[model samples]
Target: MRATVIGAGLAGCEAAWQLAERGVSVTLCEMKPKKYSPAHSYEGFAELICSNSLKASRLESAAGLLKHEMELLGSLLVRVAKENAVEAGGALAVDRKGFSDGVTREILGHPLITVVYDEITEIPEGEVVIATGPLTSDSFAQQIKKLCSSEYLSFYDAAAPIVSFESIDRERVFFAARYGRGDDDYINCPMDKAEYEAFHEALVSAESAPLHEFDQQLKVYEGCMPVEVLAKRGQDAIRYGPLKPVGLTDPRTGRRPWAVVQLRKENRAGTLYNLVGFQTNLKFPEQKRVFSMIPGLEHADFQRYGVMHRNTFLDSPRLLEQDMSLKKDSHIYFAGQITGTEGYMESAAGGILAGINLARKLRGQAPLILPADTMTGALVGYITDETVKDFQPMGSNMGILPPLSERVRDKKKRYGMLAQRAMDSLKAYLQEQGL
Candidate 1:
């Protein structure tokens, strides 16, 4: 049997690899060299277009648990990410160029997989998986719009600005996590009440970059809200959101400051740090002017300014099944950010499920629907749950997973048990399937 997988992104590559590995001939379609999306540049498959970090790697964390589940399902991108990893404290950060090149090599070298470098303006006949990412081309996006009856949904994602670590005033900053949860994996810039007030006012008053016609309709997701838009909600709105000072104390003042700005390590060298939860669309000059108000960032050199972009997703709850196949069309399946699963690994996991399920279908095997206790299952469950109201893209979080049968009190121990249960369940399924 043959499969056509469009868009050789992280999701597309994962889907194509999984199918090809299962003795299926596959065509991995990509438009990188022939045409590029606004967010893409590299002429390779599975490019990391956003932040290089794949989030925290501890099993007790939501992202880490999801990744563990993906590994059990044989995810190609996650495996390659670890191979090209660089330290970002507790998170898995990869050398972007190297990771992309590695994924491209494997996908191209596969005997069953054929790389097709062309733009697909319309969905093809026969078994197909559309893993095209949020930045899908306008022509194909129109086709998707027609197929889904104009329910092609959207949300805005804004990236945080990166600043040079050397430019920061170390004397004014301290290294510590909130209540020292893990090792000192973050750089904290403290703010007094007076300083916070000044910063808050400047932020809400800052000028923003103009949006494109498509982006003008973008509704900001709470998870990635622009700092300026968040600040204007109220005077202390940002204080409770990104800049909250809870569980942290300023060594300089020997007490918790009114608020704080965190800079997370952007790469292994620690030369760059991204402004944590500081997504914004301010003009480049405005970002420099306003963000410099923080004590430690007085001379901060911004490596990249935050910018807003449009992300297109489907109303999956009403359109897709647990196996990620469209309910109305058995031969068509969907995956990635376009299917309403957010984050890098979350999208890749969807691809894994789609590819595996498609292969199983061709072999006349039953569909694999994961239980809600697992992170991967819970995310898929959420996107495909028909009872959901006003569906929105969801990233893996501990809250989504079903509660353990035996309630454990300590947050860390409880999460650890939850992670173990998911692993055990998925392992049992794999073993039963003789996989």
Candidate 2:
């Protein structure tokens, strides 16, 4: 059998790989160089348009467990990501360019995969996967809307700024991770009350970039909320939100700082680091002026300024089946952020299942519907649950999984047990299905 997977993003690449490996001919389509999304610039597949880090990588964490599950299912992205991994303390960070280039090589090298470069304005016939992503082109988005007969819900998401490590004042910063989790993997810029107050004042007053016509009436996603927008909520809002100094003592002061700004490694070379929780839509000059107020970043060289863009997702609960196929048409499947599975890895996992289920159906085999207790399964369940009203995008988290019979109060121990249960359930289910 043959399949057409549109949009050679993380989801489309994952989906195309799964089908090809399972003895299906795949046509993977991408629209780059010809057209670019507001956030995308790289002319490569599986581009890391946002942060380079893929959240925490410890098996006890939700993101880590979900990745382990994907590895079990022969995830192409996960394998390539680890090979291109950068030092991110307890998280999995990759050199963005290296990771995307690696993925492009793998997908293009696959014997059963054929790549096509064009904008798909209309849905294809027969077996098809729509992984067009959140910043889908207007022409194609309208086609999707007509296909589902449901209005797409959207929210604004922002990217943080990256500063050159050499430009950061070493005298003003200390290297340490939160609660000493990593081996001094982060550069912490401590702030006294006076400094923090001044920064907050400037951030709230900074001029933001004007929104596009489609982006008016802005609704921001809490996960990627611009630091400036969050600051306007109240004076101490950011202190509790992004600048919280709950852990780590400043060696210079011998006490916890009033607030702190963290810079995380953006590549393996450690030449660049992104301001943690500093996503913004401020004017370029305003960003430089306001952000420089931070102690270590007084003269920081910005490699890339912060930007905000419109992100659109379907009301998946009302329109998609558990396998990520349209309720009205089983031949068409949706993946990625467009299907309401948010975050980088979550989108890839959705694609894995959509491809597996579609390929299996063609072979007259049972669909591999994961157990609800698994992180991947729970995420799919949330998106497809018919009762979910006012649907929003969701990412991997321990809270979404089925609760354990035994209550463990300690947060770490509780998460550990939960992770263990999820893994066992996924393994057992896969074994039963002979996968």
Candidate 3:
């Protein structure tokens, strides 16, 4: 069987790879180098426009378990991510360009995968997976809207600013991971009470770039809320959120500061670092002026300013099945952020399921509907749960997984048990299905 996969982002690449791996010829479509989205500038496939971190790499953590599950399911992107990973303490951070280049090579080199450079203006007939990302092009987005026959729910998502490593004032900042987690992989800017208050005032009062008229009624996703919008919530709100100083003591002060701003490595070379949890829609000048107030960034050179953009996703509960295929049309599948499975890995997982189930269907085999206990299955279940009323995009989290039969008092212990159970369940299911 032949399959068409649109958009060569993480999800599209995974979907096309999986389909090709299962003996299906794939026509992978990408508009990049021919066209560009407002947020995407990289000519390579699977570009990481936002923060490069793929969250934590520990199995007990939500992201870790989800990635582990994907690895088990033969995820191509996950494999490439590890090969190009940068030091992120416990998280799986990758060099964006290197990772994208790696994925582009693999996909283009695949024997059964044929690359087509074009902006897909319409949903193609036959088996297809729409993995176009959240910032899908206008004409193609319209095609998706027509296909689903539903209004798209959109929210404003933001990316944090990146700064040069040499620009950071090392005298004012200290290198340390939270609680000494990794190898002191983070550059922390400590703030005293007076400094934090001053920063907070500037952040909340900073002028934001004007949004388009249609985007005036902004619905910010909680996961990627702009720092400025978050600061407006209250004075101490940022301290508790991104700028929290729960861990680490400043070597100069010998005490934990009132607040801290963390800069995580953006690439393997450690030349560029992004403001951790500093997603913002602030005007470029405002961002520079306000962010410079941080102890370590007084002379920081901004490599890239933070930006907010409209991210569109489908109401999957009403439109999609557990297999990520459209409920109205089984042959048509949806994957990635467009299907409302938020995070990078979550979207890739969606693609894996879509590809696997579609391949199985073609071979006249039963679809693999994983149990809810597993992270991937739970995420898939949540997106397709028709009982949901107000559906929003969801990323992988332990809360979404089915609870343990017996609750453990310790959070770490409980998470470990949950991860083990998920792994065991997935193994058994795959074995039973002969997959």
Candidate 4:
């Protein structure tokens, strides 16, 4: 049986690859070049719309553990990311264009996978997985609503801005990553106490763009909030949050700056840089005016200004099965950000699970159920279990996994035990599948 995967974003690409690897003929549909999402520009699969970094790379951190798991599962995205990775201290970052182009080439070159470059206005009949991501188009989204009911979708997300390297005042912006962990990979704009205070006041008082009627109905993902929302909390909120300068010290001063705003390299050429945590919905003009006030961005040229877009999701607890298959339709599965699983890594994990299950069904085999001890399995269980109320999109966190069989008082020790248990279960599962 042929497997159809909708929306060739990160999850879709991963899902299609997994299916193809398992000897399943796959159809991968992407609405790009012909159509583009608000945040997406390149005509490529698994596009990195915002920051290039995929969070931390340490095994102790939840995101790091997820990456490790994906590697063990032979994830295409994770493999390519490692090949094209750029230095970003303890985080796994990549050359955005290289990463996407590599994924596109791999998928398109796959003999068993057929590439379709047009909008899917309606849900196609047959075995299918919807990995459309956060920026799914209106017509297709409406069709999904008709199939799954209106209550299972959402809209309104925000992205950070990108800046041209030529415009930055390099002398003022020191090169360093937080905690001096990685080599000099980040461009940091140091601020004095007075400068930080002034910037904070300006940000809080800055006029924000009026949300469209449709955008007003959507809720912002807590993990990816607009800078304006953060500023509204208080004058010092940003200083403590994105603008915090704890780990960084100015080379000239040999002391930590009062506050710092970091810009990370977005491309292999290092021509473009993205504001590390400056996701915002400020008006374009205001962004120019306010962002220019940074110590090193006095004449910064924006490659892409931060903008707000809608992100839709289902109340997963009420809608999806443990394998990311929809309850109403066994043949139809959902993965990625749309399933209320946040972050690039989390979305990819969902794709892996859905693809495995789809392949199993095609083989006339029972579904592959992931053990709950692992972060991957816990995420699937969290979304599919009916007991959860007020379901929100979640990233892989230690909190989602079950506690250790024996209680450990130290947080680090407890997390280490959890990670160990997860890996043990995943290893056994892989061996059982002959992977």
Candidate 5:
């Protein structure tokens, strides 16, 4: 049977790839080229709208464990991302264009996949999976609103800005990753206590863009909190967050600075840099005026300014099954950010599971409800858990996983044991299912 996957974003692409790989025909639909969202520009699939870095690659980290699970499930995007990786210390950073282009090429060339360039206003008949991403078109969003009540969706998220590497005050910025993971890969903008207080004053006092009455009190996703909102929490909150000076000694002072603004490489060329954890909804001029107060960004030229946008997602705990399918309709499923799974890799992980479960269903086999011990299973389980009264998008974190049969005290050893147990369960499931 043929299945339809909406949107060529990360989740949709993986969902399409999995179905196609398992001998099921898929029609992959994308609204790009003909039309583009405020955040999207490239005509390629699986576009990276935010930072190019996919976070830390260590198995102990949550993102690292998710990628491990995805690779085991044969995720097309994960493989391609690693192939186009750029140096970001231990993070799986990729060249955004290459990553998107590689995915587009794969989808267009796949024998069982047919690429359809059109905006789907109405849900298609037969089997379908909606992975419209955070910026779902208003028309399709209304349809989803009708399916799942308006109260079940949310529309608040913001992204950080990117600055030209040449625009930075290099003399004021030192290169180093936190705790010196691999090598000096991050360009950290050091600040003294005096500098930080002055910057904080400017940031909190800066003018933000006006929001709609409906959006004025928006529920910003916890994972992508706006820098301004975070700043308002407390003076030291930001210092503890994005500006925390934890792991490196500045070459100039031979001591860790009071605070630091880290700029991560946005691409392999290193021409662009992401203001790590600086997501904001400040006006463009205000962003320039305030953010430039940083020691290394005095005359920074912004390629992309920090802007807030609406990100609509369903309350999946009440709507989706463990496999990410709609509880009310077995033939319909949800994946990606739309399914309330946060982060780039987390969304892709949802796509993989949804695709696998859908394939199993097509083959007359029971959908695999992964054990809670695994990261992927914990994440999926959390989103699909009906007991969660107030549903929110969740990223793959070790906290969500069930406690081990026995506790191991040391931090690294504890995480290592958890990872080992998860992999063991995943391998056993794969062998038993021949997937």
Candidate 6:
């Protein structure tokens, strides 16, 4: 059987790879090298547009548990990310270029997978998966709305700015990761207590771009809030949130900084570095005016100023089935952030499930149902449960998983048990399928 997968971002690439591995013919459609999304620039498949870090890798964390499950399933993205990993302490961070290149090579090299470079304006007939990510194109987005016939399906998002490394004042900055971890992986801009207080005040008072009428009605996702919005909650909100500097002690001062702004290397060449968690919606002039106040960034040149964009998602609780198949049309499936599953790994998990179900449907076999104990199964259940109200997009968190048979008071021990249960359930499922 043949499958069509749209948007060669993280989830789409994973779905295509899974289908090809199952001996199914696949067409991977990516609209790049011709057009670009507001946040994406590369023409490559599985581009890591934001931070390269895939969050924590220890089994105690929810993202870590999801990664463990994906690894067990022989996920191509996970494999490549591990091979291209950069030092990030306990987090699974990768060399972004290497990771993207690896995925692009593997998909193009697969004999069963054919990649088409044009943007798909309409949903094609037959088996299909829409994995177009948060920054889906305007034309395709319209097509999706027409297909679903639903309004009020958006979750607005934004991106952080990238700055040229050469433009930064080296004398004012020090090279170090938090707590001296990761060995010079981050550039630290130290802020004295007074300096931080002044910056905090300016950030809160800075003028933001005027929101459009439609933009005003849209809700912002918690994971990607604009810096100014974070500041408005309180004078110290940003200092406690993104700009907090608790780990490192400054060599020059022999004291921990009042606050620190970090810039992470964006490419192997180190020509550009992105503001670590500084996604913002400040007007361009305001971005320069407010951001330049950082001690080291006074003369910094911005390669890309942060901008906000529209993010649309189906109310998955009302639209999708347990296997991520659309209830209205069995042949159609949805994956990625648009399905109300947040984070790269969670989206990839949805893609894997969707691809497997599509393959099963084509083979006239019974659809696979994952046990609720597994992280994969839990995420699918969360999206498909009609009873869930205020169905916002979510990352894999322990709160979504079923509670243990016997409750444990310690948080770490509880997470460990959850991970163990999930793995055991998954192994049994795999054995049953003889996979």
Candidate 3 lDDT (Cα, whole model)? 0.86
Find the candidate with the highest lDDT and give its number: 2
Number of colliding residue pairs in model 5? 0
Question: What is the per-residue lDDT of model 1 for residues 1-435, given as tens digits with 9 covering 90 to 100?
Answer: 999999998889999998999999998899879999877888988888758999989988889998988988888898899999997999999999999999999998999999889999989999999999888898898898889886667456787887767668999999999997998988999998899999999999999998865567767778889999989999999999899999998876789999999988754445457889898999989999999999899988675677777878898988998999998898999989899788888889999999999999999999888877788988898788775554556677765666667766576897799888888988887788888
Q: After superposition, how far is residue 37 of candidate 6 from its true place, in Å?
A: 0.4
Error of 6 at 315 (Å): 1.0
Model 4 regions lying over 4 Å from their true place: 157-309
lDDT of 2 by residue, 1-435 (tens): 999999999999999999999999999989996899877889989999758988888989889999999999999999999999999999999999999999999999999999999888989999999999998998998888888774566557687887767678999999998888859988999999999999999999999998875567677778889999889999999899889988879999899999999888754445457888998999999999999999989988775677776777888888888888888999999999899787899999999998998899889997888998899998898788775554556678775676678766576887799899989999999989987
Question: lDDT of candidate 1?
Answer: 0.86
- Greater-TM-score candidate between 1 and 5: 1
Instruction: Give the C-alpha miss distance for residue 410 in model 6, angstroms.
Output: 1.0
Question: Candidate 3 residues 303-395, lDDT tens each?
Answer: 567777677889888888888888889989999999877788988899899888888888888888999889999888878877655455666
| Model 6 bad stretches (over 4 Å) | 155-309
Tell me the TM-score of model 1.
0.69
Candidate 3 — worst ten consecutive residues by lDDT sum?
265-274
Best by TM-score: 1
| Candidate 5 RMSD computed on C-alpha atoms after optimal superposition onto the true structure | 12.5
Each model's C-alpha lDDT? 0.86, 0.87, 0.86, 0.83, 0.84, 0.82
- Give residue 180's lDDT in candidate 1 (0 to 100): 77
Q: Tell me which residue pairs clash in candidate 3.
A: none
Candidate 6, 265: how far from true, in Å? 40
Query: Which residue pairs clash in candidate 5?
Result: none
